[model samples]
Target chain A: MTGPKPLSNLMEQFQKLPGIGRKTAERLAFHILKADIKDVARFAESLRDVKEKVSLCSVCGSLTELDPCAICSDPERNKGVICVVEEPHDVFAVERIGEFTGVYHVLMGVLSPLDGVGPEELRIGELVARVEKGGVDEVIVATNPNVEGEATGMYIAKILGGKNTLVTRIARGLPMGGDLEYADEVTLSKAIIGRLKM
Target chain B: MPLYESPAVVLRSMKLGDTDKIITFFTLYYGKLKAVAKGTTKPKSRFAGRVEPFVYCNMIAFGKEKADLLRLNSCDIIEPFGLVRGDFEKLKHAFVSAELVDICQKERDTNMEGFELLLAMWRRLSVEGDARKQDLLLRLFELKYMSTIGFHPFLKSCVDCGGDIIGPKAGFNAIKGGVVCHKCITSDPAASRVFVGSVKLMGKSLEMPFEKLDRLKADPGLQGDIDKIVAGFVKYHIRRNMRSERFLAL
Candidate 1:
């Protein structure tokens, strides 16, 4: 026996979300149905607002409610130092650390050759333009330590070779609180190679 | 469910959902298979880093008979090939090799020769520093890989009539799968002119061992011609252009 058509439709929409199976979708749909009417309206408005209001910042490519983004617009941030990341969400990951005061350049994606992603498909040209515009001192490549990420970093360095800006890659090593014995060979080897003097 | 174990190299991976990834592996015993590694996207997951492409590992996965995707149990990395991943040129060639294997081999079809060829390519690319040697290795892998899968192009003689190909020049017919002598070239209008030197370079690269391959060298023009021929042959047989090919040109 099926319920009202509208209720089933809500459940189907919920099922389309990642990690949401049929049972979870039903549970979510029922919860929304039983919630106060005003609360449900506010929740719907919040979803709609995110879609309409949020967009990539023109200068840095991170998601922002306003043009140029808060970090890029802020005078206190170090415009001379640009940290490169793979996606928009990575900007937030770096922000959570609260230690970095530099602006960011999100490539939107990495150079995934197997998946057909190339330099032309990314925002690397925009980055070079930004750097060549001058005032930039260094570029910190903070892409992941995976093969694609490293390749992306190397390509960025290669293209920016003629420029005066310094290009540096994020160091890879064992995570904090992780045991040496538990670390993978790649991580361990990188740690040894990138070891710093006290 | 039966648990299966094999030494495999990751071909590629795609995000499955919020916290899981579907990883495709070219295994020593099982050939090409895909398995879902649950929660692999999580920062602390045990499967992290081990499932990325170019990683050679021993994997244990569980699945029922005829199941489309196996559930990954665990994997231990044998070699991550970190050096290859760090260099852009080497990494591009490595990805091309992986793409070749991914396209040519069928799912669950055991082709140990193809698997071995891929591993050898990875091993050599990881350590080989000279750019020239690296190019030769990639071409060697392409030729050997095609041969193993039964699509080896005929370079010894005329592909059409099996007559001895005489002179310092010949025409390669991508659709016909080999060199067409001057006589056969007219019949095959699609055939492209290729130097005899390029053809000999390809033959010798295939015949020579990986260690001695460095001794073989080709001029820039010869290299360009052979690159086009090998790429055309691969494209014809695979039926689609590989994404890695574009990056290799860069």
Candidate 2:
């Protein structure tokens, strides 16, 4: 049997990345193949550096070269209102809106029983313990507006049900099944404002 | 060990460790459940193609109580939602619909009605054409889902005063939950006033069924009026604006 060409192998690898399909992967692979050596080297090095240097923030799960993410360390952010999301990418999504003046806790994933993801598989217990220790007044369930996301938010709400902290779900203005990263500034801003206590 | 069976729709499936596969399904009796279909990834496995996304199946699984995963015993495909996979727009609409059910319904709690609503919409998407009609159908589904979950926006009469003063031309109070009469809006200390045209649009939306909604249309000017009313009220109450809706406008 003949092995795939180097270009074909590169396209296959690129396809493994989320949101990249076979056609898009081929385009991306060709683009990389045509790029200058320096540009390609920069791209490759950045990927390596991200793995080698980036670590999860001690307080939140956001990736950072520092122990605490920039937001976690900043004194200006409202530490009292923690905006909890499911993944590190969501941290960026919330930041782009520019409305929330709070820190975050990335659960790493929502509860997906089919994939064997449960509370222990996520950063949920740590979040609860963080709230239990006090000072935090609100926990915003900003998980992706999808099934696993809602369940994860609900489970968090139930676990933190009686705690002194107020629990709320991020308003669903972002569309029923859409990803948070795609929401416009106006909608994201309004969702933050319209968040109702759960 | 606890054993149970439920009517489920496969939302997604993927290979697991060697010879096994992990399948995620939304069920009628148990909400959402995951099972390890051991050896199902192999070429000779019985579960091949039967457990993939959009297949409506009756599943039987058993495992220790409180454990996250169950052992798969059987999966019988009742409906594949096959018609949707053939068309691009239909597939997109189906994915969005499945995603809605996946995100909205609670886990471990049976939302049989929601499960049905989702399946019905999937069936409709498979056969329906017009893009505008598809959008409205999804909106109707959203409204129904929101209502089932108890977030139903009050459409008829004042939510605060309980008066029969429905907005004939248009009027609404997003803050007050639904439509408020002109008198109540002007007098109430807490009410937020909204356009009368917007209120009428919302009234029509909440009152109409999904299949029939596609047939109902207004003049271009009136259509804009209706869209704004339904959208504003939805945005105010649901609290999150959808990106697809924004895409639709563009």
Candidate 3:
């Protein structure tokens, strides 16, 4: 624990980050110490910039430096088809796939009532409002395939049921390349239930 | 290391660190306990679907001598209860049951009756198609759960004066933990009016077997009365509003 106050303070901050332990924090601090002053300044500046610049998009709720975010502002992307995800990071996950050319709506979180997360706590109302604004054709709920996620998708469907827009949940099944023998019963059942006609 | 294994229902889970989950389970043997499932956040982790809330599984966990949180070793699902989880209304009702157990039971306290009652409720919820029946079942589960934890509201006689609750003038007092006759209604200004029929319906629901629950009937008005009485009683006893209760209106 004995160290220069500044070094210790840097380590403490590193330890606050997800997955960083005391040893890792110490190593990171020492690495910063050994690095060039300019490099460290750039690193620190980038960190500060991230905090200062990143805010949720006004339209989609995804973390972005811009108000509407690039996807929301994009002329080519289909705003009519909105992909609803649980977190801003999820937007990146879908974006990585590069197949979907639709806009996104980040729920920011799932509906977990036991943890005291309810509809009001999430971005569900915003999603409904976006759908109600009129040109939207379909909403593809891409929440995780967990109980809370499934329930959230259902809740969204119910709220949007009367709207002219179509509400659909992403299909869940065995992973590609996953062996049927190793698949759990629930996954197997879901695969069967959601099976496609060959 | 002592390995504890039991059939348990996942009450809830919370994110731990970057990849781990702290899962609370209401086990048939252990009653209620929490364990950390390592690396469960990863998409392909073995615990992916197993650690989710409302999953019923045969869980194996190991504990240190003094540490309260056990390390979850493995789990095999007994029932995923996916049918209930897939329906928003049913899911809300199921979460209410799970939350009630989490709030009322203490860690590592074994209560077989309570555990069985919860399982029965989930089983009923997963298969029962009628929405009204589902509501009735949830109310019954709440009542049964309250009694299992020793908070059973006195519905038969007056909670205040031990007098017979004879007429429509009776009121259910949440503060006093039971029904009050017309004379004792003044004791608690907040007590809501309780019809004799609603009181009798709750009593019968408590005593009746799970299979025969459908045989008991209450019109929409009576159902509403029981709902209010149970909600108030539970709110007063639990000391905090359930998060899931709000979403039930949706």
Candidate 4:
């Protein structure tokens, strides 16, 4: 037996959210149905408000309430070092670390031939134009350490090969508290190859 | 399902949804496998670096009841071979090798030699120093891969007539599966002329076991022919090109 058309429609919408599998989606839909009327209205308003207000920064390709993201507008930050990443979420990941004060150029995606995502599909040309405009000293590729990520990272390296800017890849190594014997070969080798002298 | 574990090389990996990855591996006992690495895309994911391509890791994977693809749980590093990712040329060779096994091999098909050959080549690329030297091993690895999958190309004899390659320039008929004799080259229009030196070195490389692979030699002049023949053979037989090569070409 099925619920009313509106309830089923709500379930379908909930299912569309990221990481919400069928069972969890069903649970969420039921929870929404039982929620306080005012609270539900606020949640729905927030979703619509975000969609209307959030816009991609023209300069850096990150989602922001304003045109140029704060990072791009902030003169205090290091404009010389631009950390290239695949998506805006990655910008958040780097920001959480808080060690990096450099601005970011979100590529929107990496070069993935299988999925038909090439350099043109990404924000690579904009990145090059930004770098070519001058004042950039280095480009640290912070794309994920996966195949497409690495390929995208290297593609950035290749494009900026001629410029005076120093190009580099974010180091791949073991996570905190990880044991040597338990590390994967690829990660272990990266750690070994990237080790610093004490 | 019971938790299964094996030493596997991360041949390919692609994003699945937002925070997951669908990874392909060439494993030791289980052979080729496609598994889900949950949360691999997370910033501090436990599976980070373990699921990256070119990595050789001891993987623990399990399936939920009757699922086709296993869920990758945790992994221990067996060999990262970091230099392969550090150097552009080395990275290209690694991708081609990984893509070869990924495209050609069938699931659950156990080919121990193929597994070992991949590991050995990655090991070589780790410190091979010269990019050309690292690429040289890929040719041999491709040959070995063909042999494992039961399409071993004939290098010594004509693929068409099983006769000797008589001329200084050996013709390669990728369609016919290997070198063609002077007489047989006329029989196959698809056959293209390849240097005898390339054909000869390929045969010698295939004959030697993986352990002594370094001893095989080819002159710098003949390297181009060797590359051509190998590329032709792989392109024709495999019918799929390595996508990574295109990025490297750029």
Chain B TM-score against the true chain B, each candidate: 0.95, 0.74, 0.94, 0.92
By TM-score, the better pick of 1 and 3 is: 1
Error of 3 at A124 (Å): 2.1
lDDT by residue (tens digit), candidate 3, B1-250: 8888999999998889888999999998888989999988775677877888888999999998557899999988999998887787788889888888999999988988999888888888888888887888888889888888898888888888899978766788888888888888886787898678888889888897666677788888888988998898898888998877877777
Model 1 misses residue A116 by how many Å? 0.5
TM-score-based ranking, best first? Answer: 1, 3, 4, 2
Sort the predicted structures by DockQ, highest score first.
1, 3, 4, 2
State which candidate, 1 or 4, has the greater DockQ. Answer: 1
Which of 2 and 3 is ahead in DockQ? 3
Q: Please provide, for model 1 over B1-250, each residue's C-alpha lDDT reduced to its tens digit, 9 standing for 90 to 100.
A: 8887999999998888788889999999988999999987665667878898999999999999778799999989998988887788898899899999998889889899888878888898888898877876787788879988999888888988998887777899989888888778878888998888888888777777655666778888887788889888999999999989888777
Q: Give DockQ per model, in order.
A: 0.70, 0.02, 0.66, 0.38
Q: Please give the range of 10 consecutive residues that has the lowest summed lDDT in model 4 chain B.
A: B241-250
iRMS values for every prediction: 1.4, 18.0, 1.6, 3.2
CAPRI quality of model 4: acceptable
- In model 1, how large is the Cα lDDT of residue B235? 90
lDDT of 4 at B6: 90
Alpha-carbon TM-score of each model against the true structure: 0.96, 0.48, 0.95, 0.84
TM-score between candidate 3 chain A and the true chain A:
0.97
Flag regions of model 1 displaced more than 4 Å.
none
As a whole number from 0 to 100, the lDDT of residue B76 in candidate 3 is 89
lDDT per residue as tens, model 1, A1-198: 299999999999999987899999999999999999999999999999999999999999999999989999999999999999999999999999999999999999999998999998999999999999999999999998777788899999999999999999988887777778767677778889999999
Best lDDT among the predictions, by candidate number = 1
Off by over 4 Å in 3: B186-190
lDDT of 2: 0.71
Off by over 4 Å in 4: A34-49, A75-77, A96-101, A111-118, A145-155, A168-198, B1-3, B14-23, B35-47, B60-67, B71-74, B215-221
